[model samples]
Target: MKKSRYIILLPLFISLTIPVVFALTSKGQMLENFKRQEKEMIFESQTIFLDEGDRNILKTYNKLNVYSSIGDKIQSKREYLEVQNEKINSRVNSLESSIIQFDKDIEELVIEVNKINEQVVSTKDEIDTNKKTIDILQSRIEESTVILLEYIVYLYKKGDYVTTDNDIDNIKSILLSGEKIDELVNDLYFKSIIQLTGQQLIEKHRDFVSRLYVKKLELQESENQLKTLRKQGILERNILDDKRSSKQRILEITKGQEELYQKYISEQLELERDIKVKELKEQIKLNNTKKKLLEKYNCEFVDIQVQQTEFSALDEQCANINKIIFAESRLSGIPLENNPLDWPVNPSLGISSYFNDTGYQRLFGTDHDAIDIMIPMRTEIRAPMDGYVVFIQPVVNTGYAYFAVKHSDGLVSLYGHVNQIDVKLYDFVKKGDVIGLTGGEYGTNGAGLLSTGPHLHFVVYDEEEYNDPLNYLNLSYLSYKSLPSKYQFKYKSDFKSRKGFEYADTSKKQSTSGSTFVIEGENELERQKYLLGTYAVGDFRNWDIWVEESIAGGIDPTFMMCVGLAETSLGKYLKSAYNIGNVGNNDRGDTKDFPNARSAIAAMTSTFNNKYLGKYNTINQLSRYGNKTGAIYASSDFNWHNNITKCMSHVKGEYIPDDYNYRISIK
Candidate 1:
């Protein structure tokens, strides 16, 4: 605490200079001008905000900055990134589908080409075998023809004698005449068996040549097919390369956009700081003037200290915060506005404890500074006034989440024990707009601060002092508009939960408790919980919580979702097993369990990014892999790629689930 001063003495040099300035200075012209300007600035602020109007006015006036909270800037930047990423992702997926199809086609062509190669090899081998058979037959036929002719000639020479003599068994007698004849007969009967006629040998040779010619034609046809396939593969690959470059360009452009948003945020922050500094300077000037007035009033008293010094002494002489203005009544500021503040929560204030209530007094060291409005979890908490949210503190070390809104005239409203904050820090919110939801009471896990039950801890502070909320609220307008049980009102309301798509069919999955709907949310972890039903059956605990998170590292959401669905059955874990790629199978004759989904998904996507990012543009390329056997993904399941593609369609809302038969009233 600062010590109170009764009087002050001016230093000798200070008093000399003060007399000089009083004689020579204009009659408060500068001071009056300053006061007028400050009052005018305040008046102008009430009617207009510099940020909402021409933002470029800051540059005109040399302000050099705009005022926006860093948190709000980050959030705004993030939303931009999300929307942009969504657009880029859509294009990428479209192009990638084509690329993947091309790959599949190319793979089929390769198989065809390989088959043609096999046929060509086989045909060439057959042609060679046929030629050798033709050569052997021709050699045998020529030798036999020559021997027959020689025998015929020899017979002619001797025919007159042999035939005229009418020799018995002339052929057998000729063979017995020499060992050569016997050898020829023995060879023909043994190894040769039945020698083919000369005409038969000639016909067989022609048939082999004809077969070889036909095979050569077939080989030429296969070679032509191979050439066509190679050309097509090259064309498809070139197209795929262009698509890949397009995606990369999109990524780079998105990165630059994010930087632009960040730069704008930085400028806004700097402007905010400058405005704050300027305001502080003005306030200090006004305070120092007030001190001079206070010192003049001190002369009215007869304290020795007051008699010892001049009225316009500086702090060096008086050592006082304010020289003479000490009474609380002299420090009255602007009065509250006539309009009443809106109720901060859906629940009425009468049902809960008021500020400084008997129970509140004992629970805390002093009477409660704020009213406690008891409301159920996830209830919409609204702002009492149009103000900018200046703070958001997430839960930390067993603490609950809380946020603060800075209103006009230094009035700040703080909300505690909240969850799922809808407004980011520095977000300008209108009256009755959602700021956050009520949290569980002080001691409840995740309730934020000290709470007794699911309720909102609302406090209104002016600068540093706390004010009773009842003072600002109009009881007539905001009294408890409820009957008996809060649950009946909470559950029966028509507030619909968010769905993934506009035409999403979630009726079949709807429940009376409003928990079973598997759909999207404001973020990823929420989506995982909804998809896996970790809140329902806990078949294999929460899995797939890392899908969107992996996207930050360049993983595609559709690819991840499809793989997760196909591999782990949307993390249903029916087999009580967990595998990100759905590839790992336990050897225990049963399904296995994983500790968490995040690490598993990380490991899986990391491997994928490493293996297929630049090399492949489609999931089919991942399925029928060409690396080492162990390195190949989904090789065992021939339909792995197809199943994943189908799942992707489902995730894209192009394929509705068969069980989505239930209906709900769309709001």
Candidate 2:
């Protein structure tokens, strides 16, 4: 029984032990499978599949299968991948070439745009110049047309048909061809003949012939009178010869009588000598009286000499005293050494009327000797030339006043109707001195009667006679020479005048402030700040602040602000954007709809950057963060990077951040 139990137990133990051994072997195989899978996965992750055909085909397969299943596919894939990589490389090269070509085309387009802009500006300038030329031409043409029409009308009125036809033809040519017309009216052919019609011209010619015939008849009558006078003169000459013969006979008869009288006179002289000797003795008695008379005469002569010597000494002393008085008077401003009258008034004064034959006399019958100046009341009257004040007093009968200034050149300036007398008679006055004001008691109506409306009835005369003041004054003489024949007359007016146009008051007001409003003081600063704020947002249309500042500082604010805009874009970056306070690069992102505050700042800052930093260094570095990509982009960082050293060099005492990473963050 024991032997049978031992055999069964042994067999059971052997069975269990065999099953355990198989389970251990299965576990070992599972661990090996996991290890192999892990190794494959890691290998697949690291390696790249190469292919020649359809370069993207390897990308579609599992990395493990790509290595295991690769046979002809592997060789073909390798060849295909080699061919594809070559084609891809070629395509990349072509795209690179196309991009380069595109860049070149863009540069050329920019140049072409600039050229077109230049052409546009040139065309605009040319158009403006053409417009100005056209305006000038139009004005000239209009003036010519009016003149031509006037000439045509004059010819028609004058009834000069032939001259009118010639003028009209010329005008028609000018109008049709737009040709230039002569400026000289005298040169025009029809100027003189255009005043009469054809029939009128014929009548005038007949009248001229009749006048010539009458003049010839008068000349014949005068010749006959001369012949009759010659006959009378011959008869008178014969009568005078007969009288001369009678006179010669009388002279021969009287010659012997004079000789007889001479002999009788010789005997009478001897008798007279004897009588004269007795008379001489009697005259001796009176000699003493004659001697006394001679003595008295000598005494009278001596007294006369003494008196003459005393008179000479007294005269010399008087002259010396007079000279001393004159010197003292000049120093004291008492007596004017020289005539103080300033330059003559109305030197350049416009002429209203001239000394013409028109019976229009200011002093009634006296002809108007000088031209009238059509000036307003209180017009500053000055002496035309250097002169001395001869007389300054009122007129005799007339209430009008006048002042006479005698010039060194034998000319006199007479001012009449003065209302005030600033300088006394004989007071020295220089040219341009305010002698008197105009229009005080003289009303406008009286002013017209006294003179022609507050005018300085300026009269120039050489010898107190009527001479053309217009010629001496270098004034227009058209009105003076156009006087009528019957009105020609001359008269002398008084030079002394105290009341005239020269006396009118012309004091000006002290201030001239009007109704216009003006801001002053601290309000100006507020205005400037307001302007700066307004300009920061780009709304700088109104130029009030600029105008005010320009007026204050005396500078053109428009030009200065334009320069600043070119420099800092009107301080836009110096301030802050509405969206992103004062932070720099705050609005940087790819979101198209988001606010590009940083871009605006960058654009403004870039201008300053280009000015401060060199194009090759800092600007090129900044281009990396921009849209362009190239070797230039690859060499620089994407963050805000600039040549701080270069920037600081350009602007001394200006701080440039060393840490570029935080620069954009810190405002």
Candidate that scores best on TM-score: 1
lDDT of 1 by residue, 378-475 (tens): 78988888666555555443355667775654566878778667875345676899877777755654473345788887878775467877656544
**Candidate 2: which stretches are off by over 4 Å?**
1-343, 346-349, 356-359, 394-398, 440-449, 476-667
Candidate 2 lDDT over 514-551, as tens digits, reads 21112222222333344344444443333343332222
lDDT of 2: 0.38
**How big is the RMSD of model 2?**
62.3
TM-score, model 1 to reference:
0.23
lDDT against the true structure, each candidate: 0.48, 0.38
Q: What is the lDDT of candidate 1?
A: 0.48
List ranges where model 1 is wrong by over 4 Å: 1-339, 349-351, 396-398, 441-445, 478-667
